[model samples]
Target chain A: MLAAERRDHLLELLARQGKVVAKDVAADLGISEDSVRRDLRDLAAEGLCQRVYGGALPVSPAVADYAARQTVTPDGKRKVASVAAGLVRPGGAVILDGGTTALAVAHALPKELSCTVITHSPTIAAALLDHPRAELFLLGGRVFKHSAVTCGAAAVEAAQNVSADLCLLGVTGVHPEVGLTTGDAEEAAMKRALSARAADTYILASSEKLGTASRFRVLPWEKVSGVITDADAHHPVVEQVKALGVEVLTAS
Target chain B: MLAAERRDHLLELLARQGKVVAKDVAADLGISEDSVRRDLRDLAAEGLCQRVYGGALPVSPAVADYAARQTVTPDGKRKVASVAAGLVRPGGAVILDGGTTALAVAHALPKELSCTVITHSPTIAAALLDHPRAELFLLGGRVFKHSAVTCGAAAVEAAQNVSADLCLLGVTGVHPEVGLTTGDAEEAAMKRALSARAADTYILASSEKLGTASRFRVLPWEKVSGVITDADAHHPVVEQVKALGVEVLTAS
Candidate 1:
């Protein structure tokens, strides 16, 4: 296919699948992986898609601010949240990452299921109050106003002391090659610190985040135990994630 | 199963039954009695449960934290908060204490109002997100989960740096003779420290707190600038507070 035709095809795939892996696109379209990367970079430059390590995602304004993100794909987020909440074993310790999706997980948690919830987001901590059986530990640090979560040296240090069974990570982007990503550098560091302290880490992202890339990388694909999204199990992104040896869970 | 998983199972039992004996946990988990005791000891140390002579008991039945407290006398809290929010000048800095009442004030803030808000509660900070023009500074410390606010030495140190135009203080008890008080000693100290940093401090309480006394004294009645409550301004408690030379503002 011509280069223009290839780029158009890639955008179509991204629009339909919510993500496009460079390697997968190359094999399907008989193009070089380098050509896929070039097209993705061009698209990112044009503000059409965001380029990640090995894939590109549809451009999302949600990364610009927390308020805008909350309004985007609300139903998808609720679905993703419900599935993620199911992963929590009763009475286990869960480290909740900050974001709208994680907040949704906190809301979806069963009121009678006793668990210890540790989070740096005051919002998530507050949501857990309705869960009468949940014990909450709020990590303290400099509050990042944009995200409404604490992030600083103190927050990172505090996260290190918590050894949780599971970490429900919220990310702005999830790419097969770029892994998990967010907007701020310090916040990304804090998230990495949090994930390091947990035995099992799952990234909670709606379909909108699939194949998207943000400014700061949080975890590599290998580090994540699973990716829970609102997409179907047979979706292309899910297939790509599974091919990477990571479990994929769909809310639908 | 991992030791941590086993411990989680024991906690689940404690949540459902309120208490668990070592022998019972051992038999249920197919583990030894000694293992159960060790788990109970570890849990107790973490403050997840209370260790008794036998096994363990769920942490104190009293839910005095911010979330639990939010449901108690909510109408009264809304009255108090509405009055407190009205007290804020259009562009002045306000120091907010951590509690259900203070959180209500955050929510009651007018969207068009512009101001700076300094707070130790993550929940309060999150609430202020709706106020687009408000600038928020969150204090750092060990999060006192019960109140959904930061406390301890670090939180106090952080509070010292902020000089606000007004402080909205939340307390568990506001007595005519005993003054302002709360449940935890460190939390009281943090509240006192926050009050000292603000130019003027107002205590937000409902009728239930008017004549009650808590464990830790946060301030003397003489130090508070005003007492804001849901009771009538002519009520006895209002008169008592006014006699102490503190201004009293009632919602109705």
Candidate 2:
């Protein structure tokens, strides 16, 4: 693993265990104990963890902070988020699906925009808490601990009642014929309900997400109104999606 | 256990297991198989569970609804809820701590009153999902599944940044000297932050909480502005709290 990915995994493990031992980190990540200690020291400097006798413990419950998420896909997601946010207008009610990309759209939303954002993702709801003018409708259902989102029938039913202005989706896998898909079956059901409620739809993705397929299908390419991605979104791939009458927003 | 408690526990087991045999329920709850079958039949009649071949199972996910929480402290919480909701003004920003009493207050809120509500409880956030005019902010933190609330540094920091007009607190335990207390240390830290950031703080607690103390201390009694509770809060024990200069609101 790259040093960055190792640090991210270390942080995730510490979050789950509430502390981490240098020995365990070394064994788990196959890094040297000295290197593990160095990583812990680096994280401790940022106040993300506190180095102790042998392992590191969280300095604050703030370990759940989205600072880690912010470090990911900064530019690409910002552009995609801008495109998705533009689709929303004041007084509009919309559904936001869970994923780093959907969270990106939420992160870039103008604080002055007033709208109702319904979402299953706890992280997305957290992202919107500081949005002074936005109204948030968080769906309730069985909590999926790993993804920090809600799923199951309750989430689907709650989403069904929202005849929304738009649905800003985070597509995990997309194919011309297969449409959009994800690895989680329950989230697929939630995405379909969210998609069905909206009058218009947009999928925020990174270039790498294109041409990849996960196990569960969410929607077909024909169901999406547009695709917003980064500048290097693969020329031929963008052309193929555009051929289907779907608008494409490419950020430079 | 009484037949009612047996039925509830049986339903809880079925909800978790997806199915339950009368023999297993009998062994688990230490009851006769005949009584277990009777309890299952009773729950089936209530539309809470379905009788399967040789067992019972949850009819729907809704069987695990908030109604289960209501059976916990029905009268005392309802009495406290009346006074608590009265403290909230229309068009105000209110902070709700995660507790049965605070949840009760959310349920008792006037349907048409418009306000901004900040909460750490998924249950409270879910309750407000269909409230057309209520603006909701759900704190993001490590979710504590048992309590259905988020806690840790993120939730605490989010509460700190919000200058709410009022904060409604729930007490697991209370003492005239020790103030409000809770069972969880992280939740207490969050409650302290929520209390510190609010202009007015009200502890809406049942009379049963008056003399008890929990492991985590939230605050000293003097910091609280008011205590809203049942009229029977007239016990001299509670009068000692009134003597500390905090106004007390009683539900008639």
Candidate 3:
């Protein structure tokens, strides 16, 4: 197929699935991964798609723009958020990552359950206001407008000081081969730093993010305690993740 | 129904509907409005609900908690917030105080407008994620969980470094006798410090707060540039505020 044809096909896949992997696209189209990458780069330059580590996701996830990401698979995110919120033990210190999904988790928290929530996302901290029993600690740093979260050195320093029982990390991509990833390098560093301080960490991703990859690698699968998603436990990706020894939780 | 049972029913209504007016509850339950008010007052004392002008809202807003306040008179808050947002000029640096009303102002901001918003409320910063043109700066300090904003020495020091063109201050009470007030002393101090750094400061309060009094004073009338509310421009309270040499803006 012509490069233009391949690009069009990739765009179609992204429109349908919310994400596209270069390797998968290459294999399906009988083309080399290099050719798929080149197509993705062109699409990203045109503001059509965002190029990730081993694939390309919808532009919204690639840029860490919160509002844009909110419209993609919102119900799925809510489900995942519900399951993630269930993972927090009462009275534990929970570290929440910044993203729309994490905001959902914040909303799903039981209003009467007491806990201390530390987060860099202003949105998540605000959502926790409804939980009368939550003690919120907002990490301070440079405000990243795109994601509405704090980043930079100050944020990392603050995360290092927190020793939370759980961390619900929101990421753009969760690939079996490439691991957990996000859009920005600084944000990735901040997430890693937060995970380091937590006793347990779980990635909250809707099924749309399965098999996808982003530019910045946040954590290897081994570091994550589990994967919480909206997909059924019997789903292929869920099975694959469980096969790796990470617990997989699906929201009913 | 017994008094305890009636109070339990009221709490249930507040939980489901977010708010319950005294008159309506009395009519529905075959009781006098005075009796309903007594029940609401009892609930308020027990920290189960917050008593507003003619009704009781969920506990969050009643207790100056950030999340609960979001559901109280949302339409009225939106009206006040729109007028407050209109006061901000393009390209100017604005300081926003932490509160449900200020969060509304952040949401009311035009998507295409370019400005710098410095805030201690992570919720406000997160709301600005929809405004692609605006730059956000989140001040760091001890997080005040009740209001979901940062307070204390660090937040005050950060506010001092910023010279904003305008500051939209949100408070719990706006009284002729007491001026602007809030629930916590540290938060009041933080608001005062933020106002000190701004060229013009406006208080965004709903009409229900017109004659209310809180525990801590934030600013005197002379220090404030204006009062924006959902009340009519010709209301006695508006006249009182205007007589103090402060501009009073009402929603149309």
Among the numbered candidates, top lDDT falls to: 3
State in Å the error of residue B36, model 1. Answer: 56
- The residue ranges of model 1 lying beyond 4 angstroms of the native Cα positions read A1-79, A142-146, A152-154, A250-252, B1-83, B86-92, B139-165, B183-190, B196-199, B205-216, B229-252
Mind giving the per-residue lDDT tens digits that candidate 3 earns over B40-142? 8888898887777778767653332232333332457878999999998999999998877888888778889999998898877877877888888788766
State which candidate, 2 or 3, has the greater DockQ.
3
Which pairs clash in model 1?
Answer: B65-B146
Residue B62 lDDT, candidate 1, scale 0-100: 44
**Per-residue lDDT tens digits of candidate 2, residues B1-252?**
687777777766766534566776687777788888787787889888776556665676345434433323345677788778877899998988876677778877877779888777866776665566777666555455446667776556556656798988887887887778989898888888888888888998677777888999988887788888774656875788888888888775
Query: Which one wins by TM-score: 2 or 3?
Result: 3
DockQ, per model, reads 0.12, 0.02, 0.18
Candidate 1 docks at the CAPRI level of: incorrect
The lDDT ranking, best first, is 3, 1, 2
Instruction: Give per-model CA RMSD.
Output: 22.5, 16.4, 22.4
Report the error of model 2 at residue A117, Å: 20
Model 2, residue B227: distance off in Å is 0.9
Docking class of 3: incorrect
The stretch of ten residues in a row with the least summed lDDT in candidate 3 chain A is A61-70
